[model samples]
Target: MKDDEPEDTGSTLPRRQLGRLLREAREATGMSLEEAARLMEWGKSTLSRLERGKSERVRIRDVIGLCELFGTDEEKTAAIRELAEQAPVRSWWRSYGDVIAARFNTYLGLEAGASELAIFQPLIVPGILQTTDYARTLDRQYFSRDTDEELDRRVGIRMQRQHIITRQRQPVQLSVVLHESVLRTTVGSRQIMAGQLRHIADLSTRDNIQVRILPFRAGFPAGIVVSQFIIMSFPKDSRGKPVEPTVVFAESFTGDVYLEETGDVRRCRETFRTLQRATLDDRPSRDLMREIAREHDSER
Candidate 1:
């Protein structure tokens, strides 16, 4: 990291975020990725990976070249370059590479510094809110090919990530909207399911956390085809501007997709608002969670 650059007090420090800015700059200049690669006299894949943040390291000179080519101002150029310098710093997630998906590593980097996280789950509970036993069961089912040790590591990581929700310094504002069915589904065992529901209910009481439940009677929001997704927003900078653009993160069996376009993010925000309108508020949601937990306990 550059000595002069201010400490990363928000989610924008990730190389992925820096790459996004560079990509946007290139697009704003009306230059194609291929055209820019040719103009810079670099291989097309190198430029592609750098812009996509797949490249492990980014050079300050390359960032400067792109900034100059894109006609960025001094302040923006400096911000981008500083992120490049921090790109190589190993994060806590690095140790869990054996269990974490390559595509998810970027999301982890972004999630840690997000100022707000809104998640919509149509099936299982969001991993960030799962209890250790609940997470272990889900991980084992999803990553069936992994060994026991890998499953344990993956569960550990999920639990650790929950700290962001209640962190001492600027805890992330968490808003979760869950489909009613998610509470009804039995993951590991009836006991585990009961514990998980109770845990979420407990978290709902925290000042920074908000939990809502969308009952089946409410029906699905129009134009939202995905089963689950998360929208993460970063805090404002010293200038009172967003540190980074809002990102909507969706994951599938294949890989993770991050949508940073203004239109896409706006639509997602709208969908979340619609769902929020149709769901039970925090108090009722917590009551429903306890009610479901009791159901599970009775089943056990």
Candidate 2:
């Protein structure tokens, strides 16, 4: 909030993620913040700001210093440095600044950096799996007042986000569990719904993607309504330790929540597993969606 240290909302998520990681590493060594800063030749306040995620900028050298002091392993240290590097890098989603909410912006960054995404939807198709017409229809409904051009831009953003799945370099692994209602519920029109369903089925054939549908006949897991949510985890180190902590994203009518704490992530993860267990296997799920899409086509 200081005059000299202006807000950097664009890279907020990565910076905060980096800060949390650094704080955790320091705590593991039982080093007091003051003592750690002193050893690193950094001002106590400077170190405090980094740990609290208020630093205007993050320095790679400073991050490396802390990693060395904490005796972090090579792969882990490299991962930490990568976070520091990403702290200031602006993401592509920022181009749609006018349409993106602050919280959703945070999600875009996390989604871009994540190595794996596990999503559960009790309603319509998740944005990542949504086709242009389907996304355009939803956007038109939600942004009723917006002009056609604005709506197109919004739809464009959603379509671009799907690229991460198809990206050639270490494309993210995606596991999605959709409620049968998602396929049964027609979005824009029967045509749109059919196309969307087929698109999902096609994508499921990819090596990195798995889409499953939980039928209503299967019953809700534990008779509780599990709303839509996504659990994203970052890439791992050579030793198989996660580079960044897993985060769970839950969206509602009002806003979005990011759960980064260990316990909350664990619980959401278990919930996803429960939903997954109640769903059809990957191949069956893909076939089922294709069949449903054919039904929608017949309706048309």
Candidate 3:
């Protein structure tokens, strides 16, 4: 990657890339965010959101003005202009906007760019690995206000995201640690849970995917007591240099919290290591999953 050119970060999502560019340009000007917002006649929150890649739409004219203010050269300015123009185009998830949370939309964008995903689930299956029937069952129970159409759309989004793991081109490396309770809990029905377990077993066979079971005998880690979380890492640039920093995602009833600080990321990584030490290896984990699936099938 060229020094001046933005690193690919494996993120083809142009809107996010555009946001990073704007933030970098502002910093190069050595102006505080408040000062820049004042000069641009924009609210501080708006500018902050734009810089953080939270905004869904960015104005091309504003990009031009900001590029000029930042003293960016003509060639670089034109490139940024093009990104701004493309930022408003709808991503595949845009059509499901009404069904999913706005915060989740941002997560989806980052997930698409990430090269590796390490997830730990204590209560249930992660959305990325959930079957359609299982997803529908969970969504219907949790989103009581949603109509059937909305529920279907939300499940569709989850199902589509699984492609990141199974797709032929640029498949992501996935490591999942599931608490044993996840297999024990009946999600939709005996049949549904059985299918979900079988699906997980199938996914574990893939070369790029690793699944482990954290049993009850091995006490739960303090770090995971808060809730389930996903840690995502983006690929290096063409020159094999680090591009995007690792991100830790935790979702709650209110919204999602993303931790990017080096210290925060270190803690999460360490916690994962602790969990891994207590987990059943892939082979045993697969066997246990199949065993559980058999129990569910018997009940069905």
Candidate 4:
């Protein structure tokens, strides 16, 4: 990283998507990055950066040269070049700055672009569905060192992401599956939990949103514990092919990981399907959520 090089505040999704496509195409031709670089008469690091989507600028001619070299079909080359052109565009979340971690910016971009999403939560509510108060409660604990203003901005971003699900045009088709434990788990207080449960129940009624709950009686699908994961699929292009591949997001205490390979994504999809079979139906899940919310309300 050069000292004079501009900082990457965010907005690398298109570049990252381009890089992944190019990398996959290159591998399909059975050529190593080093060999491709040598063949293109470009430095190895230059090709490496392009492949990793870490380059500051993506040149149209550069993409064309590589596509021609790899013998990529004209249709695919055009799509890949379009992605290159979009690489430098700014993302809305970039305005929030360090309030949003650099590691998390990519997921935000993917989430915004997703046409359909499958979210699984074994513990807490997913961020897009979290109410303002519920979000503040979680942030207050995790970002305890930050000033109130900083925390407010943090929560603000959470609320902004919800727009992708709520927009009147092209809203994401969202499916959320929660373990029954999430409804029972007390967050902040009984009152907060009541609001959160009711919130999910309300949102479940939307045409684009489906909420299902996995009960304890099901005893874990396949008797194996599954961590939280989100599977995001993109819209198709004029050719009826995905603009970008399906991506599976798995978050942890530290950094996150994205699974993009066909087999891995299929496995996650199957896992989600298996879990869905064990979950209560739409009406039943809403009933359970409301039932729990009432129990919280009745509590002294």
lDDT of each: 0.78, 0.79, 0.78, 0.81
TM-score, candidate 1, is 0.68
Kindly indicate the candidate among 1 and 2 with the higher TM-score: 2
Better of 3 and 4 by lDDT: 4
Ranking by TM-score: 4, 2, 3, 1
Scored against the true structure, residue 161 in model 4 reaches a CA lDDT of 97
Q: Better model by lDDT, 2 or 4? A: 4
Once fitted onto the true fold, the runs of candidate 4 whose alpha carbons sit more than 4 angstroms away are: 1-104
True-vs-predicted CA distance for residue 137, candidate 2, Å? 0.3
Tens-place lDDT digits, model 3, residues 183-290: 999998999999999999999999999999999998866643747888888877777655566777887666656666556667787788788789999999999999
How do the residues 1-300 of candidate 4 rate in per-residue lDDT, one tens digit apiece?
Answer: 011222232325566767877887899999999999999999999988887777898889999999998999866786677667763532311222332233235577789888889999999999999988999999999889989999999999999999988888989999999999999988899999999999989989989999999998999785699999998888777756665567788887765566665566778888999999999999999999999999999993
Which 10-residue window of candidate 3 scores lowest in summed lDDT? 90-99
Model 2, 65-104: lDDT tens digits are: 8899988877667656765776343221222222234222
Backbone clashes, each candidate: 0, 0, 0, 0
What's model 3's lDDT at 244? 68
| Candidate number of the best lDDT | 4
Q: lDDT by residue for model 1 over 156-207, one digit each (tens)?
A: 8888999999788778999999999999988989999999999999999999
Candidate 2, number of clashes:
0
Clashing pairs in 3: none
Candidate that scores best on TM-score: 4
Local error of candidate 3 at residue 224 (angstroms)? 7.4
lDDT minimum window of 10 residues, candidate 2: 1-10
User: Per-prediction TM-score, please?
Assistant: 0.68, 0.69, 0.69, 0.70
